[model samples]
Target chain A: MSWLLTLLAPILGGFLYGIERKLTARMQSRKGPPILQPFFDLFKLADKRPMVVHSYHAFMGIIHFVAAWVALSVLFFGGDLLVAIFFHLLSTSLLIVAGYSVKSTYSRLGATRELIAIAALEPILILTAISFYLHTGSFEVSKILTAPTSIFTSVLGFLALLIALPGLLKKSPFDAAEAHQEIVGGVEIEFSGFFYDTVYAAKWLDMLFVFTLVFLFGGSSFVVGGALAVFAFFVVLLADNSTARVRYCDMVRLLYSLAFVLAGANIILGVVL
Target chain B: MKKTIHIPIGSQHISLLEPVRFSFECENETIIKVEADVGYVHRGVELACTTKFKFKQVGYVVARVCGLCAIVHSTCYTLGIEELMGIEVPKRASYLRLIANELDRIHSHLLCLSHTAENAGYEALFMRIMKDRELVMEVQEAMTGNRIQFDYVSIGGVNKDMNSELEGVIRNKLGLLHQKVAEIKELFDNNWSLSLKYKNVGVITKEMAYRSSLLGPIARASGVNFDVRNDSDYLPYSELGFKSITMEGGDIHSRNMVRLFELFESIRLIETALDGMPEGEIAAKVRGTPEGESYMRVEAPRGECFYYLKASKGQYLDRVRIKTPTFGSVPGMIEALKGSNYADVPAIIASFDPCLSCTAR
Candidate 1:
């Protein structure tokens, strides 16, 4: 189970990324590609000779991917839960900085939005974990498992996390970073073939990151965790399909303001109730 | 104190699916000047046509210029060619072509309306409009094999014949389309915010519309009282009794309303054309060459699609000059944006349903 969790980030991340494309296609009334489309896309990209626009991009992409990988591995191996979350958050921030390094206005604008969304949602995520710590007396996933999971405090924290998931999923209303409707591919616009391929893989891994966050509430039961994760994925998809994207400024105000209130409520509830 | 402000919107903007640069000069939020620099997605297909393909192959290539208005370009090209050859398409085939063109117009107009709603941050309305358009797209797929670039119209006649099964499918789908459009029209007509944003944002007066020689709904919105179908007596339009849809405002709101109203008129035309279906060969035989120049005009989704064909003794034409409706509306776009705000630029530009492919090609 431990080893499986360690591999879960990439495998699930890759899988979820593939699913996002399929979901997008379906929303467009197209018959999307098969489930393994992301892997095929990656393989196709890998076969192409790596052409670097900037020498630092190749390294930055690797670092970003590695950061996300380490974070996912920590979460999978039942390491410090807060540490895993922090690393995942760090991966996106580093990736944004890398995205900003490109002079392409498309990527720069996208990175700016990505940074905003991350800043907006990060506190809520941290607060959710903090609430869990307040109840369970530790910041580690192993301690979370051993603690009484039935506390009202944990559920409130879970709800706060759930509320933040859509922002993390980058679904409509919160899809400012990679606003395809406006900025094309955003930070990933100039990346083509292999460089884009790595970023694309990173994006999928990001989805898996959210899925794993949902699965954390599952508390080691494989069936419950897997089912809940899938349900959450579909829920996000439904939300994406139903809503037209909001503007970046509007999205920031909505997501951050809602998150602040929700996190504040969670903290108060965790302490009082 | 007046200060010149240059605001660049789109080469890769979020509001549009394709990229085109617009330089909007503003005093505060009010737009004073607008200049559009198109040709970001130009594939140079027109130049390729002159060098690569034969006369027969050019029609298909021209249709590929725009994914949205494929039928309009193909039909305009073929109509010009047929006139050059002095061969008239059969009555039923012409009517069927009209049906395809009108169906395309409905779907394209719906897409623009939906995009307007989307850009204005009205998602529920956008989704409702899109879902309704899906039914129309289904009808299109049933008629033409594909949805976007329909390879239906060919020189002299259409490529495929619509049998009773296809006709029945079209009728049933059109009936459903009527109901859906009615609901959508109600949604647009009743919305106050939509009215506030669109009503008089881009107003082109009657003289300006005619002076600019604008075609299609853009001219009609300005009370031009011009429709090629009614005036030119081209295709099945001559056979079918067509009514000119004219509006007085010539504003963005009126343009949108004219398009919406025209969709219903197109549905009516398709029904009339289908009911009066004739029995004849869909295609006409064209072997020999034509003599002089021929000028043909058709009502496209945007406006008048003008094709001037000069034929020689050779198999291929001497020269083909197509003045798409969008090219004519460029002046009108600049005119509309003169006193408008910067925020209204997207909505105003979108109101034209500008086909850069058609214009550049």
Candidate 2:
């Protein structure tokens, strides 16, 4: 059952992306694309003529997708949460490298912001894991799932993760890295055709990975996990709709002063109380 | 490695509405120097106005200059032709012209405000404003029988007349628009995220505005009280109670506030005009060809739109020169870009509301 879920992760991610698009459109007071739009986009991107800037750049995109999928697989198969987090980090790092490999200024600027965003976000995820470890007495997802959980015990961690989620998903107020008007999709600018499809699919995997992390906060109860994920999803969507993207420096300042501090406090509380 | 990095935006960019290029020399995210290249959409409009179209037909031709301010272009050109032909447009026609121009101003300002929001990455606000702008659009369509290129203005007077029923329609639509604009104004004033992107981000002082000869909302935001409507008797704006809106700070936020407040003023003017629209023939008789040079100016939605017409009593004019507001405001735009963050470039450009099609044409 775990392996089957692992295999279906990308498909689930696609649906999640589709749903986000539809929800965003509704918030903006317009009739959005169909729920299957992401899949349609994938097929359309796949059908385009493949264009690569260089062998290294093209290769990095494929590796990025694989790393993201592997990260999801680790979580699904109940592997070490730390390993999964690191793999997720690796996936973004690879894309950053690909962005740097190009001559396009927008791509490089995007990659730079993406780097800053992860810097602000990664510590919160790590703290969440540490909080989980304190509760379950293990970092292994397999062990954590078997243990009963309540979000209230690590409520600060959950809130911190909520703060980080918009940055993770590239939503507004935290979406400077992918500000299409300013940087033209940033690191994603140079990618085209099947290469872009790979990057696009990787983004879907990222959605699942983040939401799955939220679900894990619910521990043993899939219903509770699903509910938590849904709740966080709406919060992120609201944030995206109601705010404009901040400057990259402002984003870093906010995530650190607010979110990182909260996450650190959660870890300290977990260790003490 | 160099200390400064060069970035070019435009000629073709996602954020830009028109094809004017801007090259920025930056140290990190701070823009240290700016170079702008305008006139990409040049269609030889002046030449075409002289050679291809007759004096009577040239209003329509110049109306094609910029779709957003189409009526203003035609109005200015028509006024110029009328002055040369010694045609006194009916007082009723002037009142109708004022209403159409104000409606045009409301829609254009909303478009600029929405675009500025979008460039700042507030897509939802952008969408909301665009949806609201449709109110003005419906009113425009009802008034002029067209949505955008309302060739409502002609040589002697307007092409369409207002009736009691149409006056009711105008009042109703603009009434709804007033409420929506108030909500939007509140957002522009109070929204924290919008304030971050807008407040003092692209500041141009009153000195800079006056020195650069900036016009429209861009100038008004800097406290420069120079409005063509207040200075000229081209239309019945004085009788209709039109007052220019201004705000201090000269930043993107101030410009937005100026536009939002101006929308209220525009709505008020239209309402006032409708309440007391003088009854007469919308169109007047055109007797002779335009013989002498007559220069005319109209306050376009962007700013002052000037038309210099030299005719020799023939079908075609000898010379036609159009100076659009965007063309005049380019220097002010460049001035605002310098010393700002690179991330704010798109917002600054959008805030200037530079109509490149009008500039280049």
Candidate 3:
């Protein structure tokens, strides 16, 4: 079952993304593309000739995908939460490395922006893992899953995670890293063909990883977990649709001032109350 | 010595709709110097107007200068030719021309708003505004027989007349569009993230606007209070009770507000023109060749679109000079870009609503 889930994460993530596109389209009063559009896009990308600036840049794309898949499997197999988080961080770091290796200004700018974003977001993620440890007295996902409803006790931390979700998913209001209009695809500006396919699939895997983290908050009930994930997905979509992207400085300030404080308060409350 | 990094935005870029390029000299993220190229879309329309096309045919040729404001191009050219021939367009034809021009303004303004939102990364707002803009498009099609590139204006007068069926359609669609536009305005005014991207970003002060000789909403946003619609009698603008909208901030937010208020004002003008439209010949009789020189200006959606025609009692004109709003405002755009963060470049460009097609032509 764990192996099957690990294999199915990307497909499931793609379907969810399709739904997101459709929902966004409906909100905009237009008929969106079909649900299988992401798969079609992946298949089309796979058929193109691979091009790369350097061996390292090309290699990093594959490594990024592999790391993301590893992170997804770790989450599915109920491994250590910290290990899964670290692997997820590694995945993004590899993409950043790839971005920086290119001489293109857009790629470098995108890589720098991604680094800043991860700096703001990764701390909150660590605090989330810590909050989970405090709630369950363990770092293992299995232990957290079997524990009582973590959200009930760690509501503040959950809220913090919710605030950080857009950054994790690279949605609008926190999507300066991929500001399409300003930087023209940013980190992905240099990627094409099969290498582009890997980066794109890795994005799906990353979405799965973060939403799965949202699922863990529900603790012991699949229904609650699924419900929480759906709600968060809707909120993110709404935000992506309605708001504009903020500057990197503003993004860092928001994550630190709002999400960091909330997570820190949650940890204090867990220790005291 | 501090070394400056150079960043080129386009001849081809996602943010830009036309083929204009800007190279920015930057220290860290702040732009220190800016250079723009606005000649990519030139097709020698001015030369064609004199050598290839006659005065009547030139109206249609110049209309191709910019698709977004095709009616204004045709109308301006036709007005110049009509003045050269000493022809007086009927009051009813003027009213019809006003309706078409204002409809074009509504759609063009909506397109700019949607584009600005998209550049700011508000994809849903972009789509929503575009969807709403279709209502105005439908009205244009119903009245003029084409959504864009209508060629509704001719040398002596308008080419089409409004019927009762078209009138009903215009009123109904305009009513729906007005409500939709109002909702969008509310969102633009109150949305926090949007305000963050727009307010106080890419500011062009009144001094900067004046010094650069900026026109259109970019100037109006800076409290310049200059609109060709009010300044010229090319059409029946004053009789239609036209009021120019201006704001004080001179930032992206103010530009957007100026456009929104102008949209409302356009809707009102169209509705009034429709109500008070008189019955007369759509086109006047033309017999003699145009002999004199004439300069005509129209309040295009972007700004003042000026056309200077010099004819010498012949089929072809001696000269046809076009001064597009975007061309006049290029210096102002460069001035606005200097001292702003590179991240704000797309938003600032979109705010200016630069129509490179018109500029290059």
DockQ of each two-chain model: 0.12, 0.87, 0.86
Listed per model in order, the count of residue pairs whose N, CA or C atoms clash below 3 Å is 4, 0, 0
Once fitted onto the true fold, the runs of candidate 1 whose alpha carbons sit more than 4 angstroms away are A1-4, A19-30, A77-81, A150-160, A190-197, A218-228, B1-35, B38-97, B107-166, B176-261, B276-296, B308-320, B331-352
DockQ computed for model 2 against the true two-chain complex using alpha carbons: 0.87
lDDT of every model, 2 decimals: 0.76, 0.91, 0.91
Instruction: Residues B157-193, candidate 2: write the lDDT tens digits.
Output: 8887878898888888888888999999999899999
lDDT of 3 by residue, A39-107 (tens): 999999999988778988988999999999999999999999999999999999999999999889899
Global lDDT of model 2: 0.91
Q: After superposition, how far is residue A8 of candidate 1 from its true place, in Å?
A: 4.5
- Preferred candidate (DockQ higher): 1 or 2: 2
- CA displacement after TM-score superposition, residue B188 of candidate 1 (Å): 8.7
Clashing pairs in 2: none
TM-score of model 2's chain A, to 2 decimals? Answer: 0.98
Off by over 4 Å in 2: none
Docking outcome class, model 1: incorrect
